[model samples]
Target: MAHDVQHYNLDQKFDFTAATKKGLFTVLGIGAILLIIGIIMAIFGGGHAEAGAAEGHAFHWYQRLYANLWINNVYYTGIAIIGVFFFAIQYAAQAGWSAAIIRVMLSLGNWLPIAGVLMIVTFFVASHDLFHWTHASLFDKASADYDSIIDGKGAFFYWPMAKGTFPIFFVIRMVLFFGFWVFFFKKFQSLTYNEDLAGGTSSWYTIRSWSAYFLIFFAVSSSVAAWDWVMSIDTHWFSTLFGWYVFSSWFVAGLATMTLLILFLKGQGLLEMVNENHVHDLGKFIFGFTIFWTYLWFSQFLLIYYANIPEESVYFLERLSSDIYGPFIFVNLAMNFVLPFLLLMTRDSKRHGVFLKLVCLMIIAGHWVDFFLMVQPGTLGHNGGVGFMEVGMFLVYGAAFTFVVLSGLAKGKLVPKNHPMLEESYNHHI
Candidate 1:
């Protein structure tokens, strides 16, 4: 069986039109309005304390909104970061099928550093509402707000010498994590771009070496990042598999985004080199990671349930006990696991463009819900819901994400001409 050896014009670049930017910014502008309104409501509107009620504190509307925005920022930023990892793994492994779409992956990765900055800003703004450890009174023995558990964990999250949970270590760790990821993201990106201008094996060797080390650094840093950013919200509850769970969610989401973009480009008469073989491989990844994510989810749940440990079980109890969140737990599972498993299980389905796109959409939404479940229950308790505020914040963040990535995509050629595997990628077949 002979497959058409498609030819690509390596000189072709994406022309992200001015109209597109205007439209995205308009959406972003609307989202900004909504976000501001949501923030005002949360700050001025009073409600029963959803978190920190033990010391007679009640959670404000701002705290819930902060949690919602934080989740969206982290979730979307994570997808971008994972794209770099996905590209790195492919480059390191010398995979040929993904070579044709490397630029798309690179564009996706350019959003990581920006996301890091946004996260820092949001943290400073909502430190009081999002992070319980930021409270000074919680660590004081003479203070009525004293928390023994948080005080004990001070060395891990706070400045040990200062004797309070002021988040010195936590903030430093955030800087380090994003700094390293951005550094490598730019390093690899520069090398790949240079390869297009100066085609040689020297750059490839350098990239391979950097990617090898990056994987190691990424593994440790990503896990610790998960602990600091999300898991630490609950403060008392801990899970060994939380890092893997977070990684799996971001990984699948990133692949889904890539797949959607590829399909879109193909429909636009661009990326003629990308064929069904590439699509099939992406589907396989989405399918495999969905299972991996489900495995970790179940493992985390079953152990906590069976052991009935007060500390571990509290996390689930908080989420499950909430009437608003209880139904979404099952919904999250169904969208992330059941839908993908059933849809992409067969070879034919993996190559079906429309079906794959639908599955990708579900996976993206499902993981958003997954991240929502992970953070909201801890921060907002039962106060959280999917409303206009949440939708507006998502639009604000999503429009920005789309704008940044598309801008990056337009800066470089759509394909890497100098890539050694270019020919193989163009001819890739199952």
Candidate 2:
């Protein structure tokens, strides 16, 4: 197909649509098995810490509860839920640079149901680690250590928060979150597909309506969802900044993933609908939001650290005290912040697909480290550094994430052909 140099660039068809290796899915299968075996081994392997003397409290199998499970499931599955609706957003906005890769975003977004299932499963597993509020002492009013926070809050945060509060209420909320994505995704997906079938403003009108509602849903749900999952880890500690923090990291990471995946697809000869223009746009995003995310990171850290408030400061204090985390704190900031900030500052760098690719790779790695720094110190404490558990967790999630995106690419046309501005996008050279 010869592209007209003026209004059209010969649309290059990407030939590489690699079949997702059956092995990758199988590996998740094996991981499920190993996860089960590992859980059991860990359980029995501990053959007996004397009751009430382990890790500042008694270790009980029953700690697994409703809210705990909810937290875990939402975190793991949220990438899909949030990703799809957001993709819809960029499209509804008629964003040109993002339009080329919108198909993959839709595909990854569709994986929300699967991710939701994973979230539910994690909730079930989490019931064991959390839910100490069920203890007789907390509710009995007889235990001296019992505080009003636990007792007064028990019915709300403890029982309801646990794995089985009101099964109906719990499932409804989860369903609603997933439902928002499913419905919005279908609306936009149908509209986009329709654009290809019928051109003009018809698709744009439908997309714009869907996008407005989607943003409403995105703002409300992301806030609640963040609290339900990550913030709940330290139920006692609160941060109004928490939700924004989660979004900053996930959004940037998802975009970087999109850019990298596009590059990978191009390498394999697929997404022919995409070209350097598309890549350049993605790179520009890499350059722009890399800075935005860093701002958010600094804002959060700066406020929390300077306030010197015990609750907020403890979060940082824990990180600095730990040998492993103490050092990575700077490295984490450097990669996620300083480096991307400096490197991606140039238009030339962003326009250079190869340079942008490196910047994106750096961003992705940086976000991973960000997650590591955020999670490890809190969960594993000083004793837990980057070890097998962390590595395995990364491998399992990383592979799963990869397989999901590729499988999504295989689902539809690589480029949205009938977008109202797609012609503009194709001819776009800036």
Candidate 3:
């Protein structure tokens, strides 16, 4: 597998500050639109919330639809935001090959604050509507006067505690996730920028320090965040490997997204410096992480299915029963595992821009399924499938997602010319 080096024709002093401002505006605009639409649907979801009614009960199909969309929106936000972690870790390790795309990752990573704000607002607005656990009054331990579903998990569904602890921890963790991202983003971004100008050893020293701290941060926090934000939607089900499961899904998807963005930019007549070698690395990551994702998915499923534990088995049970969801589960596996496993195995395929981009698209679509499966079960319950609301919301968020990324490109110089590994990345040929 050999790749001929390529170079961008853009000015050496490309200014991305305008692009960054534009992207920030686009993110805010799209996010604002989504927030408005989702809220409207959530508010009009049912007949109405009676002031004195304790055991509020109503079924609004539209509300369910809005909820799913909102969930997906929050999820995409989380994935995009967590990209900061990817950037920081790579920088901390002083990874040479990825230096070319570090600036792009930073642009995507900077979307964290906007995403986080939307998620928090959505949580409080419809807290009871989404999680049974959020409605503590519904779970009366003393008598059979309350909701049975909530009663089933009353022990862990402590209202007072959830009210106090849930938001506190969720916010704290969000802060931690972004706080780490911001610190590293600044440190590395600064170092990379400075290295470009100064050509000093201090840049390398700054990056080296991040690797040790990053692994520890990732190990402790990734699982906790996954458990609370993602796995907890079901509240009843739990998986020890859930953290790795989420991480693998996002890792591949995130890499593929970066690849797609580069290809997309190239189509728009930019990123000329990005070449076949970069595509090859992106393809390999897409392929490798897809396999890693599959391994985790299967390992978790096989063990849980074999154990036949009621608590664990229910996670899969919901998916196995639905029309849209059941088919989606298989598709997710096929795209994330079978397709990439076969396609990326051949060396030439990874380096071919057209082939690589198509497969990257497949991986992204598949992981969307991955996140959908993890969430839709707890959300829509039995026999859930595609509806107008889902499609409509997808339209809204998908556009917003696109707007955010493109606008973000103009934020800074596309190439991290000062990054210590920039030259290595530009010269890389594996």
lDDT of every predicted structure (CA atoms): 0.85, 0.62, 0.66
Model 1 spans > 4 angstroms off: 1-6, 29-46, 50-52
88-196 in candidate 2: lDDT tens per residue? 6776676765666677677657567676676756655553343333344545556665656546644544445442233334445666887776777777777777777
**lDDT rank, highest first?**
1, 3, 2
Candidate 1 collision pairs: 42-61, 42-62, 49-58, 49-59
- lDDT, residue 63, candidate 2: 33
Candidate 3 weakest ten by summed lDDT: 1-10
Instruction: Extract clashing residue pairs from model 3.
Output: 8-273, 16-411, 19-410, 19-411, 20-410, 20-411, 23-407, 196-418
Number of clashing residue pairs in every model?
A: 4, 22, 8
What overall lDDT, based on C-alpha atoms, would model 3 receive against the true structure? Answer: 0.66
Model 1, 382: alpha-carbon shift in Å? 2.4
Candidate with maximal lDDT: 1
Error of 1 at 259 (Å): 1.1
Cα error of candidate 2 at position 107, Å: 2.0
